[model samples]
Target chain A: MNTSENMKARLVDYIEAFNAADASRVVALFADNASVEDPVGTPLKEGKSEIETFYTYATTVGARLELMAPPRGSHGNSASISFRVHITGQDGRPAHIDVTDVMDFDAAGKILRMRAYWGADDYHVLADAS
Target chain B: MNTSENMKARLVDYIEAFNAADASRVVALFADNASVEDPVGTPLKEGKSEIETFYTYATTVGARLELMAPPRGSHGNSASISFRVHITGQDGRPAHIDVTDVMDFDAAGKILRMRAYWGADDYHVLADAS
Candidate 1:
């Protein structure tokens, strides 16, 4: 089992890499056969190829993540983080989505699966968005 | 599908009920067939009977929960909350455990499954504990 410290460190790296817009750095945290189901109900992006594409698009977008609290690690092969994703809404207004991501790690310390939890109502247009 | 508002409301209620030390109130939020996996790797407490027993002990232990972030809702039948469980350690010292709980709701808005994420290292004795 991966140590709690190691799992939490990786989660921190994910946030930093994403905020830096380094898609490669973000993708490198996942296993080759990893699966990502962002928003929990969405179709999964499977394998490194698809996962790479997903991160590329996500990183390129002007989205930034702000941690809501410290990352949490499980006794099992999982860890979780809660954050807000700031982005431009369809109407060109600044908005943020409240999200919690749970990641399951492999023996190699790479993310094997990631599921993000965020509902439609979680999106909020910033009051200052004009 | 349970509405996001309803899901989030119940999560709030759960915290309130727990803090109130009202085990019955907390148990009422769960489905008849609900299953609870506290701390991920632990054996599950299945069904309302087992779940009720689990919460009864939890609530009676003088453990208090402090939310680290707002409850998060998913597009599907799930919601999550990150919190700190404040309690007395085995040595009778003040301690806390950082935990993230994910709940899957049934169509009727009752929690069908609940999983808590926390590792052994997540439990920490307060600095003031001497």
Candidate 2:
């Protein structure tokens, strides 16, 4: 597979691992010193240990990501993925969060940096009926 | 128009001004103290003067942006746009750069923060024959 295709596959794998609540699998996709900053403007979590902790907490939230659009613009060592995250809110109702993650990869194809873009407004507490 | 539509219109206007190489028009879309980090990992250009200088240099590169996909996931005050930027390289040949810009808006609807995501590898020099 070409670089773009390879990156796309890795991206899909990362999401699948997240949906499966496999924190180890998700964390393995990153380099030893990778950094993740969810929501772009937040502080970053660096290194494998910190990344694992972040994902561990994330997986416990029972969030499932559904791709809103096919991953777009994979070039060189960078790729961007957009998806809708479904999770149960504190009120035991469904919540939807729209997120776009921009990732940069290292030579070994491990994610070196991940920046997720979304704001508080990107989240919606779905009606209980739906 | 609602918030999403308004943000989308602002995004389109930004691109249109970029394609027109009108630096003033392009910079006007941003707030006076807006911050722009093109390519995500770069040091930010903060404030109108710095932002205008960045666009000034960019516009001089003879680049035109073509939307690769409709602006996606505008919620609250954030929006993201994916596009292909065509530019004439030093070799006097066409170069295509794929870019994704995630922007945050202020209450006044001007861009408060703009983060452009793309790496050097996202650029390709088209063959003259094409």
Q: What is the TM-score of each candidate against the true structure?
A: 0.96, 0.63
Tens digits of per-residue lDDT, candidate 2, B22-105, equal 999999999998999886666899999999999999999888999865564443567787778898888998898877788888
Model 1, A1-130: lDDT tens digits are 4988899999999999999999999999999999999888879999999999999999898799999988888878999999999999887888999999999999999999999999888999987623
Give lDDT: candidate 2, residue A73: 42
Prediction-by-prediction clash tally: 0, 0
The residue pairs in collision within model 1 are none
lDDT of each: 0.92, 0.81
In the order shown, the candidates' DockQ scores are 0.81, 0.14
Q: Write the per-residue lDDT of candidate 1 for residues B1-130, one digit (tens) a residue.
A: 5887789989999999999999999999999999999988779999999999999999999999999987888878899999999999898889999999999999989999999998888899987624
lDDT of 1: 0.92
Error of 1 at B33 (Å): 1.4
